[model samples]
Target: MTNRHQKYEVLDGLRGIAAISVMVMHFLQDLSVPVLQSAYLSVDIFFILSGFILTHSYGDKLHHALGIGQYLKMRLVRLYPMICIGLVIGAISLCAMKLDGAAAFSVGNFVSAVGENFLLLPYLGDMSVGSFIRTSAHGVPTLGNAGNFPLNPPEWSLFFEMFASLLFVAAIRFDRRSLLKAAYASLALFVVYGMMIGINEGKLTIIVNQGWRADNFVGGFFRVTYGFLIGVAIRKMLDSDGAPHAYWMSGRLIRSARALFVAFLLITLFPTSIKGLYPLAILVFVAPMLIFQGAKLRPGGALSARACSFVGWLSYPLYCVHYPVGRLVFTYLPNSEQHIVGAAALACGLSIAAAAVLAKCVEEPVRRYLMKRFAGAASRSAAPPVRAA
Candidate 1:
């Protein structure tokens, strides 16, 4: 067991911000704001975060006796609670939509959409499932096109996360160095491919509806693999103790701070031009400090820590529930930009509250039990233990 404390607070804050961005992206029309339209970056941020965490947790024990089944079970328990809640809510709203003649009530459409989510196929470039914003098979009245009553609008991303994790596990089993090299090579290939297809020039819409969109999903894969490898590489570098000055030295802090600030500025200012550089910049600066600093806190840090932790804990569940909740809230409210904006904000807030409650009351206990009873201890028999500092 490593005696280092994981920076749970920092991770929590990042997750919270990411989830909020997704919510805002969905409600872009309601907010009547054009500048914040690229909230989809939140999804990318999440992929990076996932990569970071998994690498931190499992990288040192890459050859440990962890089994595929345990990994999959943990993911299932982590995912199922929120998804089940969202499904029930979606089904009810869909029924109402059918009753009101808002949707055609095609059984095929409904089943297909539901099954796609349940099977986690949407993340793989599957378009059979409708976006949460559009009216689905139930024809239920939605909050414009933004609240499509899909069981969970954000679920497509979850599938990708799961797939990436499994692939990473396989990579770890063979050779970590090879995995890193392959990830970098794949990313280079994607950027070249994207430019060839004019994705960098903003013709993504044209390629998305056609047969060649497999590359569209490649971006997502790159995002996850890149971030994960960065974290693992950083860990390995630090573990070798090759740096001249200690990581906590004042000089290192100052240099790292400058690097992080520059990276953030570049990404926020010119997102499209320097899309690939920002993560590397962050890795250069932030990752080292994070590994060394662990979870050190200042006097007022506890309050912020709790708030961020709450948000992070609720983020996944809130994401699962937001689409249906937004749809229901909008049914009674008007549909103008401002009205829908307010409704969406309210929906986001309420969903967060709902998720927090569910996390505390249901998710934690159920997850613990499932992991103990059904996840199979033999699967993770040689897994490393993570200990607090």
Candidate 2:
């Protein structure tokens, strides 16, 4: 294994760790345990990581030449397949809920809900079917808030993620010097916006918990901009001459790298039992440190390389599918603590398995098809003009 390929495996491992944390965190909702109290921070972590990976992968290539169409087509192929699958499964799960005695399970409502999910729109909106349900199974309304997907709640972040990716096309226009300056400017905007919201609303705006809210507009923007640009700044450093070697050490760095991710998993799975805006604290302080730490990871053994590669591949698929699968299990299967725990465990397993399936069956094939088209288009664009006699 080459050091080049290992560049972002640790980061990928963190993403996988976050995805599983979110899965368990949702399941633990039924049990009313606050384990993985800061697991919600995973969303912000993802926003930061997305910016890092996007810039790392495309910054140089796209900066020199703008290929917005192909760039976006690539993104769609990468992101939209699981979205489509989640929408379909969420629809089925919603219909299954109707059959299981939920009063809100009208076919008209089901169609509306599934349609919204397909658009990657927030399912917590006015037409949100999940919000109205009073199923006999849970007794309480199964939906938590209007901002989250009742059918597939975790996807709200992707709505923001997509928008952030689009913004990167604009970010590429600037050189590294200007990009960091822009990042700091956006960070200030984030701080100002967050403070205004917090002071006026008497609520913290930076932490992303509870699916969606109207007030989240400013806060969500800041959360993403700050995270995305900060990631770009980090990528700028990584892109600089002599960056990695300046920071690199030996195998102990590898263990430290692995331990950072282990800590993330442990924080997500276990009760920190710490109170007072710990999730916010993690977002404001700890998460960026993790990204920086992951950046410093050099290549280790073959096993380490392989593990990180798998982690990188699996992270996005796991994230995209977990919520719908978990929702299906919880809505249809059972509600008892023991049952929910088992269901949660089942969700974790099925998510891992389903992610592998999605990767092989959907992601890879679509990406190949899109890349082929993109190549053809680029070739045509690059072909020289012929002067005919």
Candidate 3:
């Protein structure tokens, strides 16, 4: 691989790592263990990284050209196949819960949850049908019930991601100059909105609270835009060809400084607290782009490259399936100490394998088919203009 490709590999590895953090968080939760209580914050890591990827992939299109229709089509093809799988899994899980005697399995709740999942909305706003029941052969409404892993817990993030992608597309379709300007403007507004709600209610406004509370508005908005903007800003850096100094000393120094800053922020700040220090976090979020230059990767020959790339390749599907599988295993375990650890490991491993299979067998083929079709159409359309010119 060229240096550019190797650098992308580094980012890919980081993406896998972020997904793993979330997987571990869910595993801990399911086993009733305490580790990385803030593991949920890994979503923010994903956000920043995704922002960078988007900008890298499509920033130039937004700047010098436009292709809203084709861009959205590609996004849909890339995102939807797995989502459809998740929805199917969720539906089957709900049926299994009905058999388990989970009382929340009422026809109404079942219909509502399935309906929401189908619509790509939050199931029951914040609760999922599977989560509401927790895999008991029998379902009952009680305080002991912690509803997670309903069908596809990881999908909630994807919904936000898809929405963010649309925002990016809209920037191009509308011929908006400086997408960064647009993203920053939205970020400022969201932070202020979050603060206003936080102050008024004396609590943070976290969107997607299962019942669609107004307080959750800021939370949801922040989750979508913050990471999306981070990605956008990174694209800006790459566009200038690792700007502010060109090659060697300038690029190296910029990359190093960004890495240091990102590390400091990750160690020092918490996602929940981002509401209070929103402005500062925005500045801090740009570090990843600086560090992820095409030339900075130090690939350790062959073995390391394969290992990192493998994880990167599997990360998305692994992320999608791990949480629900964790929940499923937890429900079956007999609540013994030894059992929990063993169960967590088994669940994680099985989920990762299952996700990999799905990715390879299902997601990749579908994505390829769609990409070829879309790219063909795009090429055909452009040919007419060229010939006319």
lDDT, candidates in the order shown: 0.51, 0.62, 0.54
lDDT of 1 by residue, 160-266 (tens): 66766776576554344555576577556545654555665565422211111343555555555555554444344444543325444623443432243233233
Could you tell me every candidate's TM-score relative to the true structure? 0.71, 0.80, 0.73
Q: How accurate is candidate 2 locally (lDDT)?
A: 0.62
lDDT of 2 by residue, 271-370 (tens): 5424335565565556666776687664367787677667667777777777666656656555543465676787678878987898789766876686
* Winning model by lDDT: 2
Candidate 1 is scored at a TM of 0.71
Instruction: Give the C-alpha miss distance for residue 260 in model 1, angstroms.
Output: 7.9
On the 0 to 100 scale, the lDDT of residue 3 in model 1 is 31
- True-structure RMSD for candidate 2: 6.7
* TM-score for predicted model 3 compared with the true structure: 0.73
Where model 1 places Cα greater than 4 Å from the true spot, the runs are 1-5, 29-31, 60-65, 93-105, 123-150, 173-180, 196-219, 235-238, 241-300, 335-338, 376-389
Candidate topping TM-score: 2
List runs of model 2 lying over 4 Å from the truth.
1-6, 63-66, 102-109, 127-143, 146-148, 175-181, 184-215, 241-255, 266-277, 334-338, 374-389
Winner by lDDT between candidate 3 and candidate 2: 2
Superposition error at 13 for model 2 (Å): 1.4
